[model samples]
Structure formats: C-alpha cells, structure tokens
Target chain A: MTDRYKYMEDLLNRFFSGETSNEEERELYRFFAGEDIPAHLRRYKPVFSYFESGLEKELNLLTGEPAEAAEPFRRAMPKRRIRIAAGMAALALILSVAALLFLRKANAFDPYEGSYIVRSGVRITDTSLIRPEIEATIQKALQQEERANRLLLSLSASNPETRIEQIQRRINRQNEEIINRFPNEMKESIRRIIENK
Target chain B: MKTRHLIAAAILLITGSLSANLPAQETLKALVKKCESMDNVNTSVVRNRNKQTKKLEKEIISLNFSNNQALVNEFIAAFEKDKLMADKEIEGKNNGKKTLFYRFGDTSYSFSQLNEGSASVSVIQKDEYEYEE
Candidate 1:
C-alpha cells in the first residue's frame, strides 16, 4: 500500500495524474522515456535516462514534434464559440424587430404601411368586405346588378301593357310629388314636362 | 429526409396560421371610396317580433360624417331657424318628433335635424303592417 501511494504521489507531483491536459500528458511521456531512474528504482535506469535526454524537448515549447507544442484546436475553439454566439444573438435581435414591424403594420395602425380603415357602425357586407381587392368586388357587384336588371326587363316584356300602365301611374304620382315639393326655380323641369304634355 | 420534411411542414403550418387571419382586415382605398359615396340620410331597417307576428318599423335617420363639416354646420343653422319658425307657428304644441323638408333628387323628404351633424328622415316602408299581420 505504501509503495502504491508513493508511486501515485510521485506521478501526481510531476503532473501525470488525472489533471494532465494534452500538453501535460505528452510531458509525462517525455519524462518517462529515460534510461536512468531514481536510486530507489535503479532497475528502471534506462527508462529514466531516456526521459532526461528528452528534457530539451520540454524546453522546446513552441516547436511541434509531438505533444511538444500547444494544441491548435484548443487555442482556437473559444474564439469560434464566441463568434457563433454573437452571430446567433444578432440574428435573434433582427427577427424580433421584423416581427414587431409586421405586427404594427398588420393591425392597421399605420397609414404609410398598407392598412384599411373600416366604417364604424356598418355591418360588413360580404360583397364589399374585400377592401384590399376592390376591383374584383366592384366587378362582381356590377355583374349581379346587370343580371337583376335583365330579369326585371324580361318580366316587363312578359306583361308589357300592364307593366307600362303601372309605370306611367308611378311616374305621374312622382311628378305630382315633385311639383308640390319644390319652389319656382327648382320646379323648371316639371314646368317643361307639363308644357310638353 | 424525414427530419427535413418535418421542419418544412412546421414552417408551412406557421405561415398558414399567420395568413388565415388576413381576410378580416380591411384596406385604405375602400375606406376613402365609401366616405366619398356617403349621403346626408339613409334608411335603416328595424325588425321586431311579438308572438306570431313579425313586424318591421321604418324610422327616418340622419347621417353625419367627420369629412362633411361644412354641410353639417349649414344643416345645424337651417335646423335652428326651422325650430324657431315652428315654435312661432305651434306656440304650445310640441311633439318629440318634428318634420322639416329635405330634398333628394327633386323630391321632398320629411326629416328633422337630431343634432348638428345628424338628421332624421323617413327611410323604409313597413315590411308588414301591424294591422295586416
């Protein structure tokens, strides 16, 4: 037990324990590659001496022969992680701003951005509901109106004499109402009609 | 490939969810055109039912809009003068509803100004008269 503890203690004292990084692990390899060991362990003399010759390798910290130099990935990884995190954060901020702008424009609060104001009390009609696409709606409404008028015309043609008499009576009543409704200057149209009749 | 398809489906779902609400929103040009085509009085239909009979009551209504400030003020002046004339003619006879003459396409429409910007006019005939029902 004492021998095991002593061996572990010496290994830890030279940074060959669990705490050894890539650099320190390689240092341990170099330190062990020797012929001369300590007096207590003279049977492993060649192993210790081989490591001592390579002690010059420990001094060459900048050169790359094996684990003599620092790891390239370890040196560069932190900066790359920081740069990627920064890019993600910037992207998130941009997306948030775009979302805010889209919400404001969508709510019809801005005139510069496309938005429609609705009539306050009017119940929305299906025909006039498509405010953004008014052309299509107007065309559809005009077609429907034309169809209704054509139906009316067909009905009038079917009962020509009675329909004409009824129309004449409605017109005469409307003319009387107009003549009673207006003043001298406003009644000129009715005067011309009466004279022509 | 399955993961890619799932991601694409999720994107489509999100966009479709956002776009579904588009129909409820209105545009600016439609508002301006409607404002332009407004009149001083328009008919509104009122439907009432008691037991087996459904009745329609036609009430004259006045129209006022923010854009027609000048016309509204003119109507107010005309209303005040008519009220003064009515007070002189009927001295003690006062009815809650009063009629003043309004013109529409060479026709006289009986109406009364409700306020500075609003007027009341007879709009629609009864859909079914109560006596007939």
Candidate 2:
C-alpha cells in the first residue's frame, strides 16, 4: 500500500480504538467516503458505509444541521445523563451516612444521668439529705459550747480563779473536736502543723 | 436486786418529770428582773433586728454606774447566777487602753476602759437558726 493509504488505515485503527479526536474522525470519514480506495482495504467499505448512513440519519434528526456539528450534541446527551445519575447517587450516600452517624450519637446519650458535688469536690448527691446531717453537726457544736459555758459560769459563780482551769480545758476540747471534724484537706494541714510543732 | 433497780428507775422518772415541768427560763428571768430593778440602768429589748436566717432577742441594759466597782461586781454576780454562762474571756491592754470580752450561750459581753477612766460595756446575743422568715 502507498504511504498515504497506510497512514489513513493507521488513523482508522486509532479511531476504532477511541484514540482519535472529532477533527481526526472527520478526516477519517472523508477519506473512507472517497471513491479512490485501495483493494486490500476494500473489506472496510461496509463499516465506513454504516458510519456514513449513521451520519446522514443524525443530520436528518438535527433538521439539516451538518453531521460534524451535530456529533457533539449527540455525544453530550449520554454524558450529561450519566453525570446527573452519579450526582444523585453521591447525594443519597452522603445523606444515609449522616443519618447513621446521628442515630449512633443519639443512642449513646443518657438524659437522666447526673453528677453530684458539694462545696468544691466533695460529692454529696442530695442537698436535702446532707442538710440535716450538717445541721445535726452544728447542733452538737452548740451543745458542747452550752455545756462548757454552764460549767464555767457555775465555777466562776463561787470563785473566779476556777475559770482559768476550766477555760483552758474547754478551749483544748473545742480545738480538738473542731480539728477532728474539719474537711480532709484542712485536717491534713492541721495535722502537719501539729506534728511539726 | 431487780426490785431495787425498778425503784431506782421510778425515782429517776419522777425527778425527770419534775425538772421538765419547771420553766426553762425561770433562773434567767429572775436575773433579768433583778438587773432591771437596779437604779441608773436603762433596759432595752430588740427582737429580729438582724434579718438573717434566725431571729433573736437582744436585751441591752446600759449601766450609768460605770466607774463604780461595787455596782460592776453586783452585775457580774447576777450574770454568773443566770442560766447562760460565759464560755470565753479575752483581755488585752495597751497604752492605758484596757479591753475585756466574754462569750456566753450565743451571747457576748465586752467591757472596755480608756486611759481617761471612761468605761463602756456592750452585750450582744447571736441568733440561733430559725425556720420561719
């Protein structure tokens, strides 16, 4: 075959392999439609004839538009449909994934659970429950003070010097009781001070 | 031995009942009445002035016999005889300034004397926790 025919056959092969552009395909169609065709490539006549008939039908469908001009619109229709379907599928997948995550987070939540704290870090759940307990403690302190007062007054009623001893004892007792009843952190510090002393 | 125990229990019950029947404020009221009878003393009562969680009665009796040691002694004697007793006492002196402080049952009494022989006594009663507003 001549070099030009060989080149045309190569282009036709490339077009069948979908490696040719629109302009290149147009060149291939014009070459195949020409009557000056070689003998060995004659077997490709039916295939080229089919392409010509398809182009004519497309021209008719496009209302007298050129076959080359109508080719892009025909090719773009299927591409646009595929793009729309792919976009819808992607949106559906995203929505389902978001819904699954939201459901998982909701199931992990517990509404009734709560925390309890007192002052700073001492956890005491019900304040009403702790109120009576604290009040009872203050009452005991009051009673202790009352008892000491009564003893001191009676002793001082007869002799004032007796108050000195009673006063010291009562003071010591009060200090001990208060230190014992103090919070853990305060009691620890107080103990450290006493030990150091 | 069981009959003796029962008799001892009966005696305790009777004494307890008798004591409970006696008015709790009898001694304090007598002391207050005696202090009120003293001349040259002004007595004033304040109720619920603090507006805190508890309402208390504060009995203030100002003595005009400030420099009289005899009157002070009498007053101290009367105070010691009352139901309330002083649980604490603080004394300090600096530069001819003298101060005395006494704390009783939710009550406090302080007496201070300056260098010029001017003396003043103040009594304060702390409120107990109350439920009502």
Candidate 3:
C-alpha cells in the first residue's frame, strides 16, 4: 500500500504538469473511487472524482444517451409553439377586418344615395316624400323626349303625297274594322257606303 | 414582344384620354352641379330598376329651372356643342316651344321649354327612348 500511494502521488504530480498518460489518469480515478483511501490522500480524492464525472459525461455523449445539452432546447419548444399560435391569430384578425371593410363597401354602393328635390325654395332630400315627384318628373321628361322624337320622325318621313296615301290607307283599314263589327248583311252595305265615299 | 406591348399600352392610353375628354358631357355635368346650389332650381336623380330582377340599372337626372332665357341659351349652346359629338340629334318646335334631343353613346339629353314658366333639362339613358317605343 505504501508503494501504491507513492505511485499515485507521482501520477498526481504528472497530471498537474499536463504530462500524465490516459491510462495513468484512469488508474488514479479508480484509486480515488475506493473508500480505503488513506487520511493523508483525502484532500486529493475530490479532484480525482471531479475528473471521473467529467469523463462519464463525455462517454454519455459518444454513446447516444440522453444528455444535459438537450435540456434547454426541450424547454424552448413550447415557447416556439406559442409564438407561432400568436402570429396566426394576429393574421386571422387582420383578414377578418379587411373582409368586413370590403363587405361594407359593397353593401353601401348606391347610385341614387344622394337624391333630393326642391319645393318653393325648400331643398328636400327626403327619399320617401319625394318619391312620387321624382317619378312624375321622370315621366314628364320622357314624354317630352318622345314628343320630340315623334315630331322628328314626322318631319323626316317621305313626301306629303306618300303621307296622304298612308293616311288614306289607315282610314280605309279603320272603316273595314267598323264594318266587320256589323252583322253579315249590314257589313256588305257598310263596305259599299265606304267605297262610294 | 416588349415593343409590341409598349405600343399597345400607348394606344390604349390615348383612346382612354380622348373618350374621357368628351367636352359636352363634362360641361353638362358641371352645369348641373353648379345648379344644385341655386335656390330657384329643382333637381331629381332617379335610377331605373329592372322590372323582373329589381336590380338597379340606368340613371336619369332632371333639372327644372324657372323660365330664364339665359339658362335656356346656355343649355342650347351645350347641346349644340354636343351635337358635333352626338350620334344623333333632333330639334322640334310645337306651339312656339322648342325642344332639342341629342344622343351620345348610351346616354341621351333633352332640353325643353314647357308652356308653364319652367324650362327642363334631362340626362337619361338612350335605352329609355327605345323603352317608350
């Protein structure tokens, strides 16, 4: 045992000087793991145990075992999920607001939204009260335009002789209709009277 | 292909500007807007609805002003200027009252002096005339 202690003291000096081999350092760790260490070596036992623990952690990493390095990443997973969920919720809110505005614009489009009327110097914009007047005004304007169209058509028609012939034909057709309304015996007499005229 | 696209775009822009600068319609609209603030004027705008679907269709603007020769002349001048751009024009006189009608594209305008102490100008859809027929 005195020889073993002397050898371990030599290895400790080599380790502190950074010149100890891997096998010598491992032997020193094994020696510190035994409870039979002498009272004189107790203070150095703690330093060897620390190195043993550090070597075990490196072996765990090489052997694909669970490691303390992954603990922080595992803890951050839930936070990432929460951030993504919050971003989606914000996007949904903005989309809904945009949709609402578009619907309002579509629903509010009206051609006659600002229609109004004036009566005796009073400007009235009440749609319900002026509805009839609006209709009447439109009707009057349409009628006036129709009259102008008819007058133009008449003035642009063929010569007076053609117009007179057309009028004569219309009168004859009217007479024929009137005669047809009479009885069969009186129809012939009515037609003959019309022909004589 | 890019030069062809550029030429097409230039043509489209020129035609768009030319159509937008139709002076007659612009002048009439400006006149109507100005008359809206006048005390002696009554204006009415009516949008026609489809008989079957109830969908809003064409619109008509009617303005009635107290008989003023100056206003009548202004409208006539606009009508005459529009006549140069119109597809059709008609002028008629009945019982000393003169009426003028002009059609541009799908829009028609009429200016009439009634027997009453009122003169009216109407901007209506051209289809309204066909509807009467």
lDDT of 1 by residue, A129-160 (tens): 43443343234333533443354456546755
Q: Quantify all predictions' global Cα lDDT against the true fold.
A: 0.40, 0.53, 0.70
Q: Give the candidate number with the greatest lDDT.
A: 3
Quote model 3's iRMS.
18.3
DockQ of every predicted complex:
0.02, 0.01, 0.15
Tens digit per residue, CA lDDT, model 3, B59-127 = 777888876677777777777644545545688777987788876556778888875556888887644
lDDT of 2 at A131: 45
Can you list the residue pairs that collide in candidate 3? none
Q: Residues A1-197, candidate 3, lDDT per residue (tens digit)? A: 89988998898899999998999988888999999888988898888887888766778889988666677698889889999999999999999999999999877554454566765567777667787877787787678667766765676564233657656654543454454445788767555555653
Model 1 chain B worst lDDT window (10 residues): B84-93
Q: Give the winner by lDDT: 1 or 2.
A: 2
- Sorting all predicted structures by lDDT, with the top scorer first, yields 3, 2, 1
Judging by DockQ, tell me the better candidate of 1 and 3: 3
TM-score of each: 0.26, 0.27, 0.44
Per-residue lDDT, model 1, residue A171, is 49
Residue-wise lDDT of candidate 1 within B52-105, one digit each (tens)? 332322222222344444544454344343332121111111254333432222
